[model samples]
Target chain A: MLELVTTDRGSDAGNSETAVTFERLLDLISRGDREAFSELYDRTAPRVLGLVKRVLVDHAQSEEVAQEVFLEIWRTASRFESQRGSAMSWILTMSHRRAVDRVRSSQSGHDRDERIGLRDIEPDYDEVSETVEIRIEHERVKRAMAQLTALQREAISLAYYGGYSHSEIAGILSIPVGTVKTRLRDGMIRLRDELGVTS
Target chain B: MNDRHDDDDPRLSTGAYSLDAVSPDEAEAFERATDASESLREETDGLVETAGLLGLAITPVTPSERMKAELMAKLATTAQLPRQEPVAAVPDASAEPESAAPAAPTPVETPAPDARTASTAPRAESRARSRWFARPATLVAGIAAAAALFVGGGVVGTAVSGGFGTSSVTDASAAGLAEITAAEDSQRSTVPVEGGGTATLVWSNTLGRSAIVVDGLTPLPDGKVYEAWYIDAEGAAPAGTFTASGEGTSWHVLAGAMNPGDAIGVTVEPAGGSTTPTTDPIIVGQTA
Candidate 1:
């Protein structure tokens, strides 16, 4: 349900080299190069910590977790495979997963319980970005999200932002698990298509 | 019967799976099917990458100065600096007899490889092992004791998967996992997540192996995965990534080594996992 955009905005045409740079740094880390690891951490820690903070919403714990995330990158730098994904995606994916794990482990009883009652209410997701590129990317995601059906958007956001599982989302929405799955898939596909994210 | 339209339902759940929203059981089934279909893998990868943009979409915030310093210090300790002297020069003090050993008490149970090799090690020491496995508390204690031996570096080698490769390493890891899960003195802790769920950390000292059973946990969005960690006062070591088990619970087998008094933690990390933990721990269960 997405309209094809011919615009050059948000395209990865120029950022391909950045991915290689990260891969190269990871490769050096694998060979026991501390300097490369430091460099990699400098370039990605903010991006990594940002996602963690957003998901966790606790500054103190976020810092603790961020420290753990970077330490992990140092220990497992050898495992990074450039072919599987871009360095940014690889690094950010790690950040998001770590954040979600924290959310699920500690917040399930309290934070999640509070969220269960308020599942219908949409979160105010404001990205305060000064960078032109990030601003555009945020706008693109916002526009794409707006086009999804309300149910689809809710299902996706609940899982995406709330970090709720399919069954959890179903329980919150009072819908069948199958329906939850469908809406999540449909919304994501639409979003992907809208964003022209063919990577 | 007419062709079933629902046959495609599983394929479509790629979005859910990519987002870490699929139940563990369904995710496994999807993983198997995806293994047989390259197109599905590619499609899911693209979707996951697109989801990565969602993280980038957030406003970037600077980490605390103390965090950077602490992280750099932690990394410095863990980094394998070049050895100025040969291993022979160290005299393998750890290899000496009890009298030759340092006066300080050994914090961990160091089982010498020559003394108790993995092969000669008893596979089934007692039927109590099975019974202990049935009960969470008993199982946890059993694993904790077992972990002391495992992390003490007496095992043949630490059982770790070499990245995401499909090799015999998987078989070794699977076998190692079974041993660790079955190890005596294994311990477990079920901690509450913020919203409303439980994450069970089960680990063994003998095999230095651990697994986490996540129940009623929320799934992550695309571009993110759940990363396990073994944390102590020094810092954290990355265990690995995992998904749900489809039984409303996901079981993750930890790969990194653990020390006594170390706690098992999980955080929402990037798909692979960050070198350090970036988010607050959703749950942390003490091992020692």
Candidate 2:
């Protein structure tokens, strides 16, 4: 029976165990274990869908892309190397790449221009309905993001959340592409320092 | 549009690459550079990890129940890529056998199928096999027949003993061999021995296991045995050792999970088997 818990209920503050569990599930899924796949889906579907929806901004299309991401995860679970990165990082990276590909391939130049125009007015991350642990993570990330310079924050946000290329970001911000690249690299270096992300 | 100057340093693009903001061509070039540099790869991996953290800021949205049902159904039919061990850099001078003159084949990338959920999506099954079978000089007869049996869908759930007599295989190994051969996704490859006879390598990606059956090879002397090896992009790993009967037939379940692009090789070794191959492979079965 499927446990239909939408939120990450009972998640503790420190998510150290979550990484191990995801890695183990991926190992089992590599062996064609269906139950492990189900549990993995149940645990991660909400975030996967949420991330896709954030980038694509179309509910139906987001669902479609999310489905593809999960299917890719199922097929390539064997390719997940824990030594390279966390399982969550691998899953989310693939999800982000798929969403970005869809956006780049399907959108017209005019649609992109319209999206660029609307980027400044977009809403910030929603916090009201999220669980306590998620809210805490949201707060940590929010605080880290606030440390970046305005241009750094805008460029990183547009590239990541908006799925825009560095050139597109340069066009949007009226800056040189080189400046955009430098800002992105410098900003991410800062974010890694701020987030204390160790490889 | 002289953006060439902007990307002069591939390291500059790591941030954008992690965000999936680079064009596919730029991404490919950046990946090539990253592959050659260890520090750059570490930096990129760190930034990618940091980028993944940004995903958690969004509000979680539970997918519709129908989507889960469809995904589960698709998973039931989908064949997974085989697990791959990390490729360790080995000194080519010492690793390569003098007699085996063919250069090590480059690893082929198996492209994931497009996002379309079509049930009949074409897979990279042949491409996977072509990774190890790149040199035609290494190939021999019986491949067409094996491929025909695979395409005709006549091999699934067939008795394992029927292909290679189980008399030489232990009861436990025979059972394991049967389980792998019975799997729906099992694949078979044949390699003719250098001296005489042939070896058939059967494996299932779904089961992550493999078994080799040898027939008509000259029986080894009392102090010598045939050692099986799982050769991947890194180097050769000792699988197990077995001896042929007077009739020169032997079967053994390979040790450890079979990685993608691994080729099963048989070499003559001392009775206990060496950590590394002491002689050139007599038969190398290129497995998908």
Candidate 3:
């Protein structure tokens, strides 16, 4: 089968650091805080929207999942503890999971041509030299991803973006369950080290 | 199969974890540990970075402003729905108790245009519409399928064995499949490709139609969708368009007999159906 690529519209100009702060507004949101929610939505929605577009690849599904992600944040603000992760992470995670669900729900496994690997897909490396405000931050994240081993890289990606669980990843890769575990363990440590995320 | 990773949230590896590779006990164990520890959460963050990587792979396209508007309209309707309570008629402000609370007048222009939406708003309670989720239809505004036929059921680069891999094949080729007149009665004529899934095309002369059923296929990404193609000896031509009907499976039928070719193959193309297939055939067969 030939490669079928689905292009997106925006870049992650917003750095992970600022994007990470979207959670502050969640508190206000639970209290039905209006201004905070607006601020939160402005900073986070673009990336969330982008994330949805990357996965579901359908405009309608992207929009639908976006709305649901926001609404979910509105309704479940209390469950969001900053200790869990960044606000951007929470929101983007919501968008990804929901998009995956919709994608999974719609297709019944006949065709599997969409092999959109992150490294294999985008055109940013050449454009990395381009002047963008978020370039430094974006590069930092990319560099962090590079530090991990290939197994760590592939394992984390499949589990995270592929939306497959441990068992699923194991089945796809044909690796033993133990290898999946340690790789994921080491992958997270490497990611945290990359993010400079120290508790 | 009841291993530590299976019983714990061992960050989703691609291979062994692609499907129900584990036993019930193993999956249950994994779920329990996933819930009990922060392993899943940490891995979740890494997943975002991975998602970021996936985002990078997408060729960027400028979105239309109209798409944004359409979505905003959709949000306004959905937003107003939860808060709306059906009423017999559009009511006036006369029935409210005036107090320390600000004077609530009957809204001249209801936020949502739908009748059901207007009726659903807080009856006489009339809370200010300034709530973040409750923006004026203006800010509340936003905006957000096709089947075409082409040659070969595109399924190139699909996740055949890699745990965390993706394919460039569009799901569209599944739609344009011409009915195979010969295989109508076979209960299991469809076959699975070495690529980790199965696909089948059914033909029915009475209905003058053909339909393709794909199972175990991987799901697609957003914005970029897949289109189906019908193959003819002349070359690949647009047959129709199809979105994922559900699961890792899609069922799409041709409008008429796909007599365009002596052989049929599947490939991945752009969102709109391609003039010809650019990918390899995920599955193929000749029409009887």
Candidate 4:
């Protein structure tokens, strides 16, 4: 059983569709697939680690959590159902849980305050240059996001990457909570329009 | 407003933002809206993907090459490895213990402790045959009086084959022979510094080397050692100590070899021989 999400025919004009194949590989891995799992690890580890690095902010802890999340994926892949979400969403969600857990485990707020005063540990982009799949995904999203102004991207990244709740984002931006809500919603609409998504 | 009256509600946008869907927030409003909107569940997913992309932007500290090896080793050790059968278990492969047998050279040292075989007959013969071993003269003197019956022979002190001078018992073949014959009990073959023999310990003045042939004596107690004393023929001062063994019929000169005028007498003492005799004389032999 597959849950298919319809992308705008016009918007996804150039994705090579490896995402579908990736999902298939994930399915095989769910069946105790060794080689498939290895392939999956090869393809996804960088991205998973990259994501975990953002929230956890510690390279060592991030990588460690990434491994744990992957192992968890291997163990619980059987429970994944197509109806709930895409394979990509499921894997990212798993990474989120592990990253958040790592964040909580580190008790790094004081230490974070002491270091550079940077709320979110900015990633080392020069480290893992974008892969083909990530590049494609990035291209699709950027095109959709192009509809929104640069201010919108900043707003979204701060909220998402910074883990700032809406109220906190409002306070950080020195704006009203209502204004933060408007900017976020409008930003999403512009993204949908730029991407030409049916929804 | 929909069932969710607030767009900037954290519940709505937080998950989506955490997911990295909107990619980034341009304004506080959009950021909060994304967090508030449950409809953008998948969009919030981008927060993490964005996290990944952002993570890539952070510097990487390269762990040493050995660190990776150490990691692999740890992985192998703690892999919760499935149990393989003993035959299949080769250690250094994942976590299985190495099943290979240890090397082969351990069984040969078990038999010969004294560097001599147990079956040797010299160590197994009658008490009188011990005289061939050579022993101390004092032991011979004691045995000359006491061991005449023990030898199963009609001859009494003649058992000592010492080349002694001007003694009533003047058998050249048997002067120290009583000492030699007396120590033969232990001299079963591997004679302990051969005791109860006829010949005295002949001393070398320069080297202090004394070699006495003794026979016919009892085996010395283990841990209880025998000390050889080099007494001047006048029988007063001690030269040094020789290790005495209560083993078989044999001549093992202790340290401080005898000079021409010195006599070799063995006294029982502690394990490593004492500086001087603390116990009574077990055997005293005059050497040739």
- Which candidate should be chosen as best, given TM-score against the real structure? 2
The global Cα lDDT (0 to 1) of model 1 is: 0.59
Which whole-number lDDT from 0 to 100 does residue B232 have in model 1? 60
Per-residue lDDT of B28 in model 3: 56
Q: Report the candidate with higher lDDT, 1 versus 2.
A: 2
Kindly state the fnat score of candidate 2.
0.76
Q: Give per-residue CA lDDT, model 2, range B1-288, as digits (tens).
A: 857664779988888888888888888889889999999999999898888778766678988655564454344334465555456444453343321211121121221231221221123322322433254434333334322322453323322223233343454565576556545665555445565555556678888888776654455545667788887766778899876643423566888879855777777677789998765566666556
Query: Per-residue alpha-carbon lDDT of model 3 for A34-70, expressed as tens digits?
Result: 3455456555566676666655555655666676666
- lDDT per prediction? 0.59, 0.67, 0.44, 0.43
Better of 2 and 3 by TM-score: 2
**Model 4: per-residue Cα lDDT over B173-276, one tens digit each:** 22232222222121111222332433223333444454443433443434444456666524434443333222322344444444543444555555566665
- Candidate 1 docking class: incorrect
- Candidate 3: what lDDT? 0.44
In the order shown, the candidates' DockQ scores are 0.22, 0.34, 0.08, 0.02
Give a tens-digit lDDT track for model 1, residues B58-169: 6667875445533443332243212223344555434443211111222112221112322222221122223221343454444344334323434332122222232454
Chain B TM-score list for all models: 0.39, 0.43, 0.33, 0.28
**Maximum-DockQ candidate:** 2
TM-score for candidate 3: 0.43
Order of candidate numbers by TM-score, starting with the best: 2, 1, 3, 4
Which of candidates 1 and 2 reaches a greater TM-score?
Answer: 2
- Candidate 2, residue B244: CA error in Å? 56
